[model samples]
Target chain A: MMKNKKMIILLVITILSLTVLTACGEKKPTLNVYNWGDYIDKEVLKEFEEEFDVKVRYEDFGTNEDLYVKVKQGGSSYDVIFPSDYMIERMIKEDLLVKLDKYNIPNMDKIDDRFINLDYDPANEYSAPYMWGTVGIIYNKTMVDPLTKWADLWDEKYKDEIIMLKSQRDTLAVALKKLGYSMNTRDMGELEEAKAELIKQKPLVYSYLGDEIKGEIVGENAGVGVVWSGDAVTMIRQNPNLEYVIPEEGTNLWFDAMVIPKSAENKELAEKFINFMLRPEISAKNADYIGYSTPISAARELLPEDIKNSLVAYPTDDMIKNVEIFKDPTDIIAEYDRIWTDIMSEE
Target chain B: MKLKRAAYPYIVWMMVFILMPLLLIVYFAFTSGDSQSFLDFTFSLNNFKRFFTPTYLKVLTRSVNLALLSTIISLIVGYPLAYIISKEKSKRQNIMILMLVIPMWMNFLLRTYAWLTLLGRNGFINNILAKIGVSPLNLMYNNKAILLGMVYNFLPFMVLPIYSVLTKIEKNLIEAAEDLGANSITIFRKVIFPLSLPGVITGITMVFIPAVSTFVISDLLGGGKYSLIGNVIEQQFRVTGDWHFGSALSIVLMIFILITMAFTSKIDKEKEGGGGGLW
Candidate 1:
């Protein structure tokens, strides 16, 4: 009887080893998703892996331009990517993205109607809205007086204490909006006016910054910064004294959307991952992990009441009426380039 | 035959990595890159023409100007220090050189980032100043800060060459100058200075070229307040996706550095022909 039991155990071990060998011979199909660094929840990826039983290869890109270049250079194959509205428009124009099959993405209805049919991806043909946010003034109240407007950035008292966004569009948009002009205006005269305003404001600017503004503001290096909403929320948490104010002049409203690249080898799996991300629970978890406002209305409902009602994260409808989205300024970006170069090169 | 065969890998490396990229740059520099396709290009001078604008010219000149200023400062600061170190006992001289080189062991970016902490508005220096009831000075986000970062980063480049040359100069020459009734000043001006010319030139070349082409120091210390030529080229390739224009600016920057290099090589040849060597 003991020999018989031993023989049964040995037979089971042999079958298990054979199964492992075959599994190694033919691996699961993998889906590669490249996104902005630290832009997603860790647990959501694990959930996708378990639910789909497909291998997941995740990579992070520092910037949208870096992602575009990687795809253009054909160095690495990526199944899906997260790009902002302007970059999405550029990709669509360049034919770098594959059109989404709406049938596969059943959770697309979860995305708020307000977030859909935008200039960057009209009719939801190519991209699904992920996280949306606005750019605004993040200030340390102790160092700065109640900062309420873009003009407050150029206040003489804040000289050498202001940090402006480093990107040409973001900074130029601030100047344009301050002057009550449209942010996406290609008119050279308006751009020049904006340039002059920026030059005038330069002496007050301690540093032109990117994502590092959060650390700088929270650390009290600068009194005020023109920063993104999600980063502002993070900074406010780090330093309770710091407050975020979207200036009365208005700001840039941006959406980062997920879309599959045309070079993706596993389109079906990529669509599955996108649909997985849009599931209300997954989206809410992601929104809680990442401070950015969720685009899905269902996900927004799931957010903690304090964060969901926060004026900085979700501004009132009347307040955001004048806010503009960046259209892909393809033809005359060179002009903005020239203006920015001139502005930066000024002695 | 064995030695030649051993060099085969490096030759392949030079062809694949170095020469090919350079040739590709030249190819891109002359092409109209509206489409960004490698094959579908027209031979055009538009890239070069775009470079002649006053805006770009001013940026180029500013980069050169900043580099020249940093080189001059490094020479002034490094020469005396190198001389002092060379005049020390051999063991102490090695210690001094090592001390000069220790900071470089840390990454250049790390060293520059450290400067951000020390010179920032609310950084350590300002914290100290505030204790004494002194207003914090704006030590960053300007040309001066950029110059400081460049000098701090590249001073070793300047000092090592000068120190090497100074140490190599024969003590007998100094003794002979003194025996001829020449004072220390005369010995330094005529004998020591003239003999260190080769090292000075090498130091200048090393410091000036890197300073002129540096994007990181300016980006970090200058706080992206102003655009240098290096910044322009970086934006063209990385930010704007205009590799053709970037290649053109690179070619232009290359021409500037090449002129300095050629001029230095000519000086080196003259020094060698005129018996700049002592031993």
Candidate 2:
């Protein structure tokens, strides 16, 4: 009888302690922020949490498509998301994003005017610019000749020595650009032409790859690879023998931006976090760590002289002659997917 | 009553993890992708119709072909190893089994990724070849490489089951077969092999199912030249955002595997009946 009374007393103490701990946890509102994997500095997030006295729940996604599917399916609520050009457009079309209040994000002026009012978020109401880059060839100078044109990728001399992108849009865009067609073309005939071109080039190609393309090139397993400009910068740093080129036939100029999801519960806190990230020092820190170019002009100035002057990080306008930003391929996306499947399914 | 209550947690787990997802897959497979609201779904056969075309059939055929080739190779290689291990002393058998399982302790993706270094142009093999004044050979980015990966990963799954069954055979039965004037080969064929049929069935299922559904191994080793059904299904959900078509493909693959399991079990039952008659 004495043991049973002691047990009841112990259980009561445990229950009271648990409730107190949970009550402590509930004191601070959590802001869930989802972004691309390895894309942040992490220190900035910690700094924001300390500054605002709000808990930040951070998660990462592998691809833009993954981000889109996760948000669209709607199990978890994310206050802030970082999506790229075409993806931002798609989310706006689906009414998945909340319009940003300029009053909350006063640091919006830090972003360059050139990066503002872009096609993805035309009025700059939905998204804040984060980082931007171009898609081009990164090649070993010792293995291949100077690659000036996208048509050079088709030359038989580089047989089993070229690494193409595994991504459907990126790979298809390469073929489309080589054929002197727009990357965002809605015409079925143009898309079919690109598909045929890829099929023809498949024999000469070494493999279709994603992040592994960097390792393959640096290890000298492949002579040439099609990669984003940011990855090119990092690869060049790893192996000085590598050279980056935006092909004369033109390529994709892409942007990644921050937006609030419509399901966000902590809208005000999310804005505070975005404004914190837009600070010159914080943006510069992220740019330095991530090896991606920042859209903030002030952040660019604060970067080290070598990084600031690096042509690959910030290409001159004339250098990218016919570069195009990817738009939401809403109408032609299904056709594009079918063509991609066909290209990948070819025996 | 205690045992029944103990199973309640597992029942709840199954309902959430297995049964719910299965029902959801069936629902999504039959529904069109056009619906905006969560509750309202337009039931349609379009997803299934899309999968029945010549292009998708080719992908399915490729996945089955690769999986079958890997399974056959595994059985041919695994059976002898299993038999040899089963014949060993108990302590030594345990050691050998531990050796087999130790490689599996490492992550599967890491193990597969390590093959790239061993098989690449400037890799360990080619580095050795270069010292001998022989040119580097092309070993990566091919179908043969993909088969090697599947066999390497799934070989243990094929071997362990057969070994356990072989070890469990009654010693007296083998002794009696020998006393009755049966040779070693004759004894194995007439007695041991028949009894081990259940293990062999399990081994095949364990290896074949995973090999058929594997996407990572094919993506890494096959060099993205062609799409397996696994890759196609993954593309639909992740890349193309067509969960309806992805669900349909998954349903079809599941049915194909179920048919395979049924056929294997029938063979096992037939063997059991014949072996009982022999006894």
Evaluated with DockQ, which candidate comes out highest? 2
The collision pairs in model 1 are none
Worst 10 residues of 2 chain B by lDDT: B270-279
Q: What is the DockQ of each candidate?
A: 0.53, 0.72
In angstroms, the error of model 1 at A85 is: 0.7
Return the DockQ of model 1.
0.53
List per-prediction Cα lDDT, in the order shown: 0.88, 0.90
Which digits, one per residue and each the tens of the lDDT, describe model 1 over residues A283-308? Answer: 98898888888888788799999788
Candidate 2 residue pairs in clash (backbone atoms < 3 Å) = none
What docking tier does model 2 reach?
medium
lDDT of 2 by residue, A1-347 (tens): 99999999999999999999999787888989999987899998888889888889999998899999889879999999999999999999999999999998999998999999999888999999999999999889998887887898999999988999999899999999999999999888999999999988888989999888999999999999999988888899899999999999999999999999999988999998899899999999999888899999899999998789989999999987689999997677667777887887786
Please tell me the TM-score of chain A for candidate 2. 0.93
